[model samples]
Target: MQEWWRSAVIYQVYPRSYQDSDGDGIGDLAGITSRLDHIAALGVDCIWLSPIFASPQADMGYDVSDYLAVDPIFGNLAAFDTLITEAHARGLKVITDQVLSHTSDKHEWFQQSRKDRDNDKADWYVWADPLPDGSPPTNWHSHFGGPAWEFDPGRGQYYLHHFLASQPDLNYHNPDVVDAILETCKFWLDRGLDGFRLDTVNYFFHDHELRSNPPAQTRPQVMATDLYGMQKNIYNKTRPENLGFLERLRTLTNQYKDIMMVGEVGEMGNRSIEIMGEYTAGEHRLHMAYSFAMLGPDFNAEHFRNCIEGFQRGAPDGHPYWSFSNHDVPRQVSRWAEHSVSEDAMARLSCAMLMSFEGTIGIYQGEELGQTETEMEFEELTDPPAIRYWPNVKGRDGCRTPMVWEKDQPNAGFSTGKPWLPVKAPQAAKAVDQQTDDGIMAFYKEMIAYRKNSPVLSRGKTTFIDQPEPILAFTRKADAEAMTFVFNLSKDTQEIPMQAEAEIAKGNFAQIKDGTLTLEGNGYVYLSHTGKAPI
Candidate 1:
């Protein structure tokens, strides 16, 4: 099998927000097909699209109703075939989101599973009887809110749902369920998909004993998105059985050439590294896995060091994928709002840091133009979680707003009608057309092209330099050429002490001539060693 995914830069496209060719206030496959030129021009290796499967849009396509069919909201199967063909013609691989951990309540399997206990698919979903007191079998909490178990009146039993009740968790312990999911995946693989971005990869299995999760030993006061994180969530998710399933998934995909799978592990802090390590430890499992380590609000030198170094220690032989932004989280620029760098500078610095690392990188759409989170009012919200937990949480709708294409155009060229989520003025200001001349968009194109052309940036081994707070320094060396990357995470200027012989190679910093390399607040510089490179 060709390992083309490694050293490749992937661009994530949220289908519902990428572009609306029909002016239906939602993006479709045709819209994505029309925009392939823009993605190819950006020089991305592959495009990872969010769910386009038939869905009720309960979780914005995360709750898939049909695995083998395309939703009319996005387009028909013909549109998908055209998209894959067009992307391949542009020399770009295509990947789609695969939500195999669970399916929508409307899915046929789940529907039959909830009909009665003696049904052929009774054991398809995780169903259990209530306790003596008529309470849920376990004290598990849903990601959205309330209990993870929902009672079905027809079956007189409670079924587990890690997310909203509209999504019911599949029983991986059931061999038949595994066979069905594998078949569903084969359906897509037969259609020539390059790979799949597995959603909630760690949540594929649960403890079969239905044990209650122990409470988290420590609890810091947090009001962010309810009390979902208050517990350890050991039994609720991240079970050992998930690894077995992942191995099987890998076995299925490995049958095809150049096919890869990247799992999204949502574990936080140090545990995230452990999960990533275990998932991608060998060739028989996931090709690559990513954690929330780089997607959070922590931007300090220690946080950055801890994340990368932790991954290095945990996954010594494993390949990891690093990303800064996605459809679920707020834009990195706004999340790290304390850093006072301009949007243009920050975008370049972010791309440099990600591409400089020793692994595959994922870039969210509109990030090339330095887009920020949309400032949305509560009234315009369509996200269920945001509406449910209003005032305290801003929900994900702000980050998942329609992509802005043309500046000074209606809806910023996202839609002819009102967008699903209102686009903010600040974000629209950085639209694609406005920055085409000489700004962040152009810089992004140049940087990506450079990453593709340069051997050190594209495929090299990384070495970290132990520096103080707010300053991150690393080196990527391939063959005889070694490039040192230094970053300033703070809003204040910081000086990186380097030898007099170090020569600046390619970066956006201003002070590179002096031995004391100066980075003006969130600035970064790349240097090529004129002397012997640091071992």
Candidate 2:
């Protein structure tokens, strides 16, 4: 059977900010179900939901207390089932966020593990004896801030947490822990979940020797709030043992037909591409993997080329899921604003470029409307990293503000009550109703339709062309179908001599004149050496 996810276009829905049915200021599963039409109309194949599992909301549901139960804030299990049923009815597969690396400190297992050294679940979490001076076991730092180890008075030892102290990392070294998490995965799969977006896939295990990480070879010009990036982080995450667990996950998902698992590789720079290759290199591991490489502030032609070509070189068989924006990072428009003439132009260009890539693609909620990040004051922050580092580091709340659906309605029709995060005028101005005839929205719909109708853009292999600065060029080929794609990455016009054999196949916002392809700022075109264009 054909794997449906290979060329699939997925839409990500941050449940808490998507829609609210109860008017309680938080979005719910029922509200998501009500908005299924919006996603279906985008011509996407699947919906990847951020975690809606039971949690303390310490890290906004990244700290899962019960993997099997739905959080009441997002509605109950019945509502979740209805959502699955409704999404499937609309031909949309559901991929849920699985926070397998850690659990809320309030979890029953964590509660049991912390009580004593020999409880039934005592080895379920990564607990270590304190140093001679009662300091943390290692010098590893948390991703959020502070040491990665937390002290447990009852057990007379320290437990590891790569994130918040309220969320403890699971001991994947223990067979029982692995078995339990696998069972949790099966529980959801048996309930008709299409697949999982494995959160922090590389942080499944820490070094058994509790070694300290070496200092980073280089530092950023801007000192980040957490010095976690100041070290190489070898001791804490991306251990070789992670591969075995992923294989186990693959084995479990294999029992169900066409079930896909896309892992999130939480590394930075070129190492991220290397790890993405390792995790998804073969049929026995993750179906696909994504990294923070594209989600960061890099928007140049060389950076994009290196990431894609690097993946091809590392994992010849591995598949990648490319997404420019998600709930975790700031939205793309704001991050790459300096390179574009206007926010709307950048938004349209992003959709075109991402869809043209050769792998699975994801569209974050509100991106289609050309939504910019909502600027927030320190008091309005919810993300942990931003809260700790205040003025210097703005948290994810800026990009995670409520999705705007209506311009005239209260709270932009996202909720009947006040939203958890305010919808500022800049974002509210781009609301769905107001963008009905908006150029950016229409361009997105057109681009998505064009990608779906063209085989080369969806499944073809890529070969990049060497071009001047601000001009990115590549050719995608699948069997007899071959198409060349070119884009102007800056806010200035660029001209490239067209290949003698190349002809305009299907294009947008670009023109061909005097044997040279003229691309206005943020313009793109697709060329083919065939008969009349189909799109």
Candidate 3:
């Protein structure tokens, strides 16, 4: 039988910004437990929380110091256990972000690995020697900036870090490291966790030869960042050995009943889809995988269709998880402002389109309220990339602002003290209290309910219907119903032609005579069959 994730909608919750029960400025496990009703009301089948493990917060929680202990900044392990128990009691599955590609320098394993060579844990991390000129061993650059190699004075050698220098990449070639990670998975699975969202799954392995990466043959598909783009990134990441480790992780997850694993592949463009295909191709690997393809600023009809169809073409039987916004990039409503009729319309339309896709869906916190990216100043920056790149890259902290529940509440009920990031008036104005009815929040709730009740949408085969540019058209067919979805992705009005017998079924659509339908700028229509439906 197909798993629940095959047709489920998972919500991504950035714990630091979700809510604060202790008024500590940072969101915590108790904060999430209090907001369970808000998430359950959205009709999402599961909740995927970002890292909450023990960390120094150098890269926020991405640099995990302890794999098993919950960070005191977030909460204790008891708090996490209560969160899981309460979330399950409310009928919501919980998945957490797992950073397996690397460990924080403060991690015990890395600490020991850096304490000279020839120790028991010395081979746990990827460390190499410098060149004759005392330069980095390879030409590969870090995802953040500078060379991927960091010189550790303790070991008198360079350690590889695909991202920040503090986040040393793990050496998965060591069987003991693999076994330790699998045991960590068992720790969570034993605690009744539904699954994990593996962070940087493709970076789990690197070429053992430590070869220099080749330069890009074509203009790299740059995603608003120049770092790690000019090179082909062949030798540093996405090694073939990574597949065997994924199979091992999958084998561990399969021991539990209905446990699922979804990996985050960090490659750009269609390569992300290719990795998703490979990682989830068989039952021995991940149950599903997601990429940054839709999280960026691309919003045309062709781009949307290509992302979904690309995955389908790559792995016909593999499952996929889709999201437009996360803790990483700018909110979709603001990122796609060029194509929005208005922020309100864009948020509603985006929710509709995401739910109509052929895979599991994830709605990041505050996305339901149509949250816009906070315009933060240099002084307000907490992200290292933003601090380093300054004006060039605004950084991800803008989109990672605190969630606003009430307009009048302090910090929008996210905290009692000052929030980690300032809560702006523009964002507070669009809070949940102001969005009670006939608002984007309401539209999100209704759309999620609509997906649950509609058979064609919930359990149907998607068939692409050819349409013009900036207008995506597709049909979903089930046992007894067939539904057609159409959208205008531009700021200008477009005329949609359909069969005379086709009736407007979902959303507000004004039909015209002689098979001509007019859709206002960014308007969408979800129609059902009134005549013989084509399967």
Predicted model with the maximum lDDT: 2
**Model 1 agreement with the true structure over 1-535: per-residue lDDT tens digits:** 3378888899999999999988889999999999999999988899999999999999999999999999999999999999999999999999999999999999999888888999999999999999999999999988888899999889888999988999999999999999999999999999999999999999988899999987776865387554667778899789999989888889999899899899999788889988998999979989999989888888888887888888889988899899999998999878877775676667777877887788888999988888888877889988887888887878888889888888688989989987777777887888777886667777778887888888888777887888887888888888987888888877788876656567666666537544578888778877778455421
Task: Enumerate residue pairs that collide in model 2.
Answer: none
Give the range of the ten consecutive residues with the poorest summed lDDT in model 3: 505-514
Candidate 1 at residue 481, lDDT? 79
TM-score of 1: 0.97
Q: Which residues of candidate 1, in runs, are more than 4 Å off?
A: 530-535
**Any runs in candidate 2 off by more than 4 Å, and if so which?**
531-535
- Residue-wise C-alpha lDDT for candidate 2, range 1-535, written one tens digit per residue: 5599998998999999999999999999999999999889888899999999999999999999999999999999999999999999999999999999999999999998998988899999999998899899899988887899999888899999999999999999999999999999999999899999999999999998999999887964355655898888898999999999999889999999879999999998899999999999989999999999999998889999999999999999999999999998989999899998899889988888998998999889998899998999998899988988887888899999999999888989999998899988888899898886656777777778888888887788998888877878888887889888888899888877754656776565688887788888998888876532212
lDDT by residue (tens digit), candidate 3, 329-423: 99999999988878888887898899898888888888999999999999999999889888888999999999998899888878998899999
Predictions in order: lDDT = 0.87, 0.90, 0.88
Ten-residue stretch with the least lDDT total in model 2: 526-535
TM-score of each: 0.97, 0.97, 0.97
Model 1 CA RMSD to the hidden true structure, in angstroms = 1.5
